[model samples]
Target: MTVQPIVFFPDQRLRQVAAPVVAFDKSLHDLSIDLLDTLRAAPGIGITGPHIGINLRVVVLDLPTSDAPEFYVNPEITWLSDDKVQNEEGSISMPEISAPVERPTSIKIRYADLHGNIHEGEAAGLRSVCLQHEIDQLNGIFWLQRLSSLRRNRLIARYKKLGHA
Candidate 1:
């Protein structure tokens, strides 16, 4: 698998909802692999299929503590805790820009592996933030939508200044 080009932020593809991954086949597996390569090339911890314009509910995350990237297909949040935490978040598509985003501090999610085996898990802290962010991408909710209007506008201006708008 090879690293594919990212779809870049402000690209409408990033805002379009992804279709559920239906076939647990070679193409899906390859796309997941390519996603990992692309995420590593982008040097980001997490990325979704929409980041590369695939429009499928897939995500890859390479946390600093892990030796390999984790893949999630058609992941859905099952439960969200009342507790909230704010962390500086950015996207592979939107390089050189990040803003503090507040999200549920803990979450329970259900997703499928490449083999189509469904699994449920709970995450907290950084993992929680990453999952929520990527799932939102799958749901057509950009991280900018999680920010205040003023903050979102400022970051957008900065991105434009970076010549990416």
Candidate 2:
């Protein structure tokens, strides 16, 4: 697997909503592997197809202490708890900045495995945060968009000063 180049923020493709993966084939499997490799190389806990310019509803997550990475194909949040928590979220596309974003404390999600098998699961804490973050990417919402206007503007200015934005 190759560690594909990530598409940075402000790229038009990052704003485009990802298309759902329709075929469960070797290409899908290869994309999953490439995503995992790219995530590891980015040294991030999670990544999605859009990060590497592949606009498909795919996400690869390697939460801390997990035995292996998890791949979600065409993931969708089916339910979210009213209870919310604030967590610091970042993205590989915009590596230099992170801000606290409020999200559901727990969520029920439906997604398919690489083999096209459907699964539903509940996630909480960091796992839930990561999933929500990546799903937002799949839906064309960059993590920075989660921040408030003041915070987002400040972060963008900081990013620009750092020569990354």
Report the number of clashing residue pairs per model: 0, 0
CA lDDT scores, all candidates in order: 0.94, 0.92
Clashing pairs in 1: none
Tens-digit lDDT string for candidate 1 (17-116)? 9999889999999999999999989899999999999999998999997777799999999999999999999998899999899999999999999999
Give the lDDT of residue 41 in candidate 2: 92
Model 1 poorest 10 in a row by lDDT: 60-69
Report the Cα lDDT for candidate 2. Answer: 0.92
TM-score of candidate 2 on Cα atoms, chains taken together: 0.98
Report the number of backbone clashes for model 2. 0
Worst lDDT run of 10 residues, candidate 2, spans 141-150
User: What is the Cα-based lDDT of residue 100 in candidate 2?
Assistant: 87
lDDT by residue for model 2 (12-116), tens:
788889999999999999999999999999989999999999999999999996899999999999999999999988888988788889999999999999999
